[model samples]
Target: MSVKIILAGGGTGGHIFPAIAIANAIKKQQPDAEILFVGAKGRMEMEKVPQAGYEIKGIDIIGFNRSSLIKNIGLPFKLLRSFVQVRTIINQFKPDAVIGVGGYSSFPVLRFAQSKGIASFIHESNSFAGKANMMLGKKATKVFVASDGMEKFFPAQKIMITGNPVRASISLSSITKEEGLKYFGLETTKKTVLVVGGSLGAKSINEAIDAGLEEFEKNNLQLIWQTGKIYAEKAKTRAEGKFNVWVNEFISQMEHAYSAADVVISRAGAMAIAEICLVAKPAVFVPYPHAAEDHQTVNAKHLVEKHAGLMVKDNEAKEKLVSSIIALAKDEAKQNELKQHIAKLGVSDADTVIATEVLKLIKK
Candidate 1:
C-alpha cells in the first residue's frame, strides 16, 4: 500500500497554498501516495484543496475571536465536535502521518493522530507561533519553521528551518516582465505597481491607495491593483479608465501580476512575504496591525532589517505607501539592494525538503 498522509490547515490561502505545495511535492516523489486534506467547514480550503486535486473532509471547527467574545462562545462546543469528526476521518483515511500547517482546523486532526501513536508533523509559517501549534509541537515528530530562532516556540530538537513552501506558479514561472504586462493587458513602457491586501482587503491600504491614485498618474506609473473583494467595487469606480490603472477583486494570474510589477505594496502575511521574496521585488509592507501578537510586523521587520523591503505601518500607510514605493522605484541602487537581500531569503525547494523530512519520520 502507498503512504497515506493527512494534510491539514487553512482558513485562508496562506495556509492552503503551502499545504498544496507540500502535497504536490510529496506526489512528485511518491506518485501513488494517498493525500487527504482536513479543513474547516465553509472555509476557503474546502474549495481550494479540491481545486488542487485533493480529497478533503471538513471539520466543524471555529477559531477563537479576539474582538468578539460572544462570537467565540460556541468555540468550546465546536472544538469538541471537531475532535469527534477528526477521529472519524483519521479512522477511515488511515493516514501514515498528519501534518499541521498552523490554523484552528489543524488542531483536532493532529491531536487525534497523536493519540493513535501516529507520527505528526507541524509547519509554523509565522515568525511568532500560534498557541495551537505550540501545544501540538510538544508531540509533533518534527516542526518545520519558515525561519530559524524558532527554538523558543517548539522543542529545539524538532525544529527544522525549511522555510515556507511557495506556490509552483511563482517558483517555476517562465513568464517574462513584458509577457507578464501583456498578460494583464498593461503597457510595457510604464512602471507597474502591484498593490495587494492579502485575500481579504485591508481597509487602511484600500483607503490610502484610493486617495493616492492621482499620484501614480502624476509620476506616470501604471497600476495593477488588487483591492481584494472588500474594496473592489469602490476601487473600480475610483480607478476606472485612467488608461493606466487596472483594479480588480483578485488577480487570478499572480505570476503575471508579479512579473508585471516594478514594486509591490503588500501586507506582510507569511505566504505573501514568501511569494514576494520568490519574485524578488522591492516591496512596501503595511503590516496588518491586528494579526496574532502583531507577528506580521515582525515578518516585515525581518525583511526591513536586512534591507530587503520598506515598511509603512497600518496607521501610517495613507501618508507614506505610494510615495515610498514611488521613491524606491526611482532609486536603482535601493531597488537592487532590496531585491538582492529578499532573494537571498527565498527557498525554492522548501516543499521537497519538508516532504523528505515527512517520509523519513514516517519510517515507511
Candidate 2:
C-alpha cells in the first residue's frame, strides 16, 4: 500500500529545511510514498518547498503579533480560516499521518489531524518547545526533540530524542576547503570566516561586520558573508572595493560556505546550531534576544556549557562578535577543541531516524 503523508511547517529556513529533509528521507525509504506540504501563505516555504520539487499548499495563516496587539485583531479570523483550509486538505488528501515540523501552519494542520483521530507527529527542533507544539504534543503519536530533558514540555512517553535534521547538502557535503574558496573567488591560503545571520539578515550582526571589514584585512583573513536580502545592497556597497570579502544576500550553496570557513559567526537558531555542529566548525553564536521564550540563548548555552561552542549576547554583538570570531580563527588549538566537541554532538542521520520512526508508527 502507498503511504500518504502531510508535512507542515515554515516561516524560516530553520523549520523549512528540516521538514524538507524528513520529506526527502521518507521518499528514499518508501519510493512510492505520497507527500504534501502545507505552509503559511506568503511565507518563505511557499517558494522554498516548491524549489525542492515538492508541491506545497499555502493557507492564510499568521503567527500572533507579539509586538503589537492592535495588529492581532484579525488573527482569530485568520486562524479560523486556516483551520477550514486544513480540514479541506486533510479530507481530500486523507493522509495516513500528519507531521508538524514547527511553524504557524503546522499548528492548524496537526490540530485538525488529531481531532479526526489520525496519527500526528511533531519535530520540536528547539531546546525549548513552542507554546503551540507543547499544546499539540499531548495527543501526538510522537514528539521528536533535538535535546534531552524535553519531558517538562511534552509527555515523557511520547518524546523521542531525534536530533534536528540537517539538509542533505550540508550533512553529506564533499566540498573541500580549496574548492569552497575557489567557488567564492577567495585565496585558500587566507583563513576564512563565514558570517550567517539566518535567512533574514541580522541587522546588528551586519552592522558589526560592516564596522569590522578592515579588521579582516588586518588579520589577513577572507570573508564569506551571507547578509540575507534586507541588508544585501548596503552590505554589497560596504564590500565594494574589498577583494578579501564576498558578500551576498543569500547563499544557495551553504555547503561550500561551511567548507571554506575556519570559523563561523551565526545567529544561534536551532537549525543554525544543528548545521554548525554537523559541519564541526568552531563557532561564535549571537542569539537573537527577542526569540520566543529566549530559546536561542538556551540553545547556545547548552553548547557553551559543553564547550562545544562560544556565545555572545545579541546586544553585545556589535562590540564583541567580530573580535571573538577573529580570536577563535587565530587560536588553532581552541578551534580544534571546539571542532571535536561539537562533532561529538552532531547527528548526521537524523532524517533517516525520523523517517524510520514514522514508518514504524504507520506500520503499527
**What TM-score do all the candidates reach, one by one?**
0.98, 0.99
**What is candidate 1's local distance difference test score?**
0.91
Could you list the CA RMSD of all candidates, in the order they appear?
A: 1.0, 0.8
Tell me how many clashing residue pairs each candidate has: 0, 0
TM-score: which candidate is best?
2
lDDT of 1 by residue, 202-301 (tens): 8988999899889998998999888888899999999877978988988878999999998999999999999999999999999999888889999999
Q: What is the lDDT for 33 in model 1?
A: 93
lDDT of 1 at 265: 93
**Superposition TM-score, candidate 2 onto the true structure:** 0.99
By lDDT, who's the top model here?
A: 2
Model 1 TM? 0.98
Question: Candidate 2 on 165-206: residue-level lDDT in tens?
Answer: 999999999999999999999998999999999998899899
Task: Itemize residue pairs with steric clashes in candidate 2.
Answer: none
**Each prediction's Cα lDDT score?**
0.91, 0.95
